[model samples]
Target chain A: MDWQKLISFITVLVTLFLIVRSEIKKYKLRKTRPCGSDCNCAVLKEVSLKKLK
Target chain B: MNYFAIIGNPNCGKTTIFNELTGLRQKVGNYPGVTVEKKEGKILFKDGTEITLLDLPGTYSLTANSPDEKIVSDILLRKRIDIQRPEGIVCVVDASNLERNLYLVSQIIDQRFPLIIVLNMVDVAEDTGLIIDVGKLSKLLGVSVIKTVGIKRKGIDELKRAIQGKFQVSTAVRQWKLPEIVREEHEELTQLLIKHNSVKEDVAVYDAAALLSSPKQLKEFKDELKPEILDHVLLDHQRLESLGYDRHSIFVKSRIEWVRSICSEVVSIGEKKKSYTDIIDSIATHKFWGYIIFLTLMILMFQSIFTWATIPMNFISKGFDWIGYQLGALIPHGDLHDLIILGAVRGVGAVVTFLPQILLLFLFLGVLEDTGYMARAAFIMDRLMNKVGLHGKAFIPMLSSFACAIPGIMATRTIENPRDRLVTMMVAPLMSCSARLPVYSLLIAAFIPNLLVFGFWNLQGIVMISLYMLGLVMALLMAFIFKKTILKGKTPDFIMELPPYRLPSLKNILIQMWERSVLFLKKAGTIILGVSIILWFLATYPKIENGNPSEKLAHSFIGQAGQFIEPLMKPLGFDWKIDISILSSLLQREVFVSSISTIYNIQNADDKTVSLKSQMQKDLDTSTGLPRFTILTAICIMVYYVLAMQCMSTLTVVKRETNSWKWPFFQFAYMTGLAYLVTFIVYRVGLSFI
Candidate 1:
């Protein structure tokens, strides 16, 4: 492969690594939730931005 | 202990009330036969009483169309009740839109159940300077009315108390007001109810308009109704229409008038909260820029699916393949080793191939939906879609199809018009769904030289972009043709509310992503596993010893099946191996590439390390003296798969949503036929150029 092609491949590889890292972090976060009584703790609401305003 | 159900149109806040009353005590499970969920919980009142709250699907009216709407009618007549019927019903009405909301309320009243009204979003209406006299309105309707702002948990305790206040085993049955003449006729006829003082176990409106709106319900009512009751009902409906009030329409106009009158009495204008959605929507739904944004979003979606998930894909493929090899070494030599290495482990590895892209697809979709941007996306796309003699609702299905066609087609349930939905489903597969990306990425990398065009656009990116556009053009063209011919009908009038933008609920996004991944895995476990084993069996059985005993899979059942189809596809430059892979892809399109690898005995080849492009470059037909993959052949295959509806998951969704195998089966047949014809044309035309 030419230098440009090699560089392109490496750049893509880096991007791929970043994508996987982000995905695994998301998975780990989700897994810790563990389908318990606490699942409903999502607390569907705005973050009280009124106070900040 | 009696049960009650809360039902209304979407955004009615049935969920808010359920959360307020039940807290975390609800059980969320699927309705039987379909994946649509049912949420139910119980509340104990201070008066030594308890009530079960069934939060049915948020629906506009009781007419059964989609499985979601079917929940309303099903729960009312207690149809398909493995569980007990509720003694009472609470119909939710958005207070601001009371006039429109009460259309459903009146319909429920006709069912002759112990009904109550939970007027939600009262605060929003009040903030908009609208007032409502709840007591006066309650007296007019002769039903208990409870005011609630479910988001703030205000008046929830009162609503729960009211629910418990009226959970009687029975209520006095009152005939629906069908104007003067119908009231007189009802007096003359025999009592339709089980008792005068109790709610009718069942009630039917002799209104002609109701009959016109619902064929399924009318058909059933005709079989069961008393001759006189049925006769008078039809007459009353006609008489009302003569006065210019269609049974269904009049019921709405009057209720809306009543609600408006009550609001005039008690409500006053506050500072008008300007609808921010309008300002944002104006730009997003613009004719030109809206289309631009839609295309940009689609391109970004494709980029995420193909470019973002490469690492996880490589890891999974390499890891799984390594595991397969290790197991092969550990297992004793025999059919057992073949089954373990090539069938079970290899099959799993094959399915995992596309998991990264699927995950990314679900993640972005979840984010878009949870963040409330998808609603705006539909709104934006709707403007352009309407010009083509299609409804605005077509945008939702095509938008959702970007994640995967199956869910997208199923999502078409929200589109009220049947003809519109059918056309949407038929064309939805043409969207660059997550499923097609794997096949596209693999093929493009192998065929299209990786070089920049215009010193900017990568050749691979350009090809990917072209494939997406091709698919979209094909879908729209197909929809246009279908609308004009096969499923020809008037394009339904568009009416949809564009909800305000909200920060995406991260929790909801994560949960949705999890659910989709689990479902995909389950399907992969069954269909992909089965295909892999059958494939391994095809490529392995009846081995030729010099080439290895496992070389001649042609005598196997699957191999024979591929051979049978090979002659038809040979003109397209596809050999028997390609034929078999294409057949396997009836379950899923990605399986085609993996099957090709297996059939060619390149399953053990490290294509990732050597690059699939180089490997394909080296492969040749032993007798033909030409490479197996010519430029024309590559283009033909790409064009063919782009238009094909090869995913069984998509068909299953069509079947469930349509509640009939007819539409789904038709979709499969037409798509495959289109694929074949297009591939043939491409191959023939491109070969002439060469």
Candidate 2:
């Protein structure tokens, strides 16, 4: 394939991968952990300590 | 290797000290089975002995009321397998508030670990006319105490040396005498724990006290400890409560007394210093002036985002245009050239041109936070939040949502009420994030007049503010409705400390700005790049055998699809092209801008460098024989975007945050339905007038 076609194919594949990877990971995590309604890990603040000093 | 922990009360500059000691050498991971982050760093001594420093979550005490506090308690109690128990503890304290801050120190010292107390923010204490005798305090607590201003990096060398030196276990365990009954109960628990092998024989007295004091602590060790051991602890707890000796209060009272005794011995006050921070707080948290100031600041921030980013956006747009023009000339006029020019470059450029505005928004946020004003903003918004049925703390996450909903939704962790947190997460995306800026800017620039509202105010900036406020108004309205009906719960009180005001460090603000902007640019390069190519292919395929290149777009798959949906978009003044762009926007909101650019580039292959704005302005409606982008149409589109759930990534994040398909789907349905209704109203209303 030409560079244009080659680049377009790779780009499409990468975008699909980026979108799919997170969904699958989140799916597995939710299924396995099932931390009730209150345990949304995404909202957890990633701080070196509590509150930004 | 020696393991050490840095523990402190909130806002005592513990994080600053950790950053100084670690300096970009720390790893952030989640504590096992909990979402709270676990931070660990390596500190190398001159003698080549390495110390692993764990920055425990800052809590007032080790009582474990919150998940973060539980993580700290577990590590200190040697109950976590993910982290090793520290051999020594660096108990950071705020010297300015020694009486209150030392409460946690009393608890830490009870652990009987080799401890060093770094009295942080000594400069603030000295400014407040409080003189603390470091040697005397150290002697009283029976631990080494070093005074340091964490921000100024003063006394750091001494602190490092003290950490490496021969460590001494604190005598506070012996000094602060517990009640005879409680002491007897603590010993019985320790013996029981050791007998059950739930705890080592060398367990600290405080850890034993924690077992009897906190019911949560027993639950944490439920699998390890025998049922009878837990029953016995609960039995002791009941016995203490029945005898009018509340274990929790008794422990708290003893710690407070210990802290007060140490303060009286080592600290002297020359005068009660009056604070400028107090004066500022009075105004910033005032009932009336605070709201006015907040609104004015928000208006100014939005105005600057629109005005300041224009020049850089223009430069980026032009640079991309010039490159596309060059590529068009160098490459042969074929499918390959068209794909490169229309598919990738224009798509990325459409999103990236808005980076300057994104960076400026984050810069202002960093400043507000660093100056200790963000907490006050939350305080001011608390009463208003209560009116809308959300806890006052919901304002912080909603404010964060103005930047991005992912982190904003993530910030809901601070909210204690599950229903309040869910409501906040569901409505967070209604806050107009930086991603929506490009669409609003483009539509406003194309259709809205650039004239001033008065003699001085820019009309365009006012429109930008209106668009943002539209989102805010809708968010509050939806939060109110949801809280009252679906996710009903009592509003929790917002309790937070207001840190002393200090000059914001320019380095930290710039670093924050860079990180946020880089994340936006990365999306442009990766996700937008891919989507654009897919869109280009759809818009260029199934070409007619003998058609003009410009007309070939109408014959392509995308054009047919757009036409198929054209009737649905007709009432909102959107044509086939706009319909296609809207469809593409489902992946990402900013993709709408790029999709339009790609479509126009494909149609206007003859005119290479004409800007997308002029093309949008010149686009004509076939039936009305008038320009397609009218003031009414632009307003309708902006209104639509303000309410639409266009970005798929946000939905995924919502799913992850809510941990169910139910909430994300409801969010998507309600938002899309609201967008259509509002857009129809705005469009119909505008058409009636003009």
Best by TM-score: 2
DockQ scores of all models, one per candidate:
0.02, 0.14
lDDT of 1 by residue, B377-473 (tens): 7666565576665667677768667767855665565555667777888889888776676677767767777786777556776778788788877
lDDT of 2 by residue, B475-516 (tens): 999999998898877787768777778788676677778767
- lDDT for B547 in candidate 2 is 76
Stretches off by above 4 angstroms in model 2 are A1-53, B25-36, B44-51, B83-87, B165-168, B200-243, B246-248, B271-274, B546-550, B567-573
Candidate 1 chain B, poorest ten consecutive residues by summed lDDT: B27-36
- What DockQ does predicted model 2 obtain? 0.14
Comparing only chain B with the true structure, the TM-scores of all models are 0.78, 0.90
TM for every model, in the order presented, reads 0.74, 0.87
DockQ of 1: 0.02
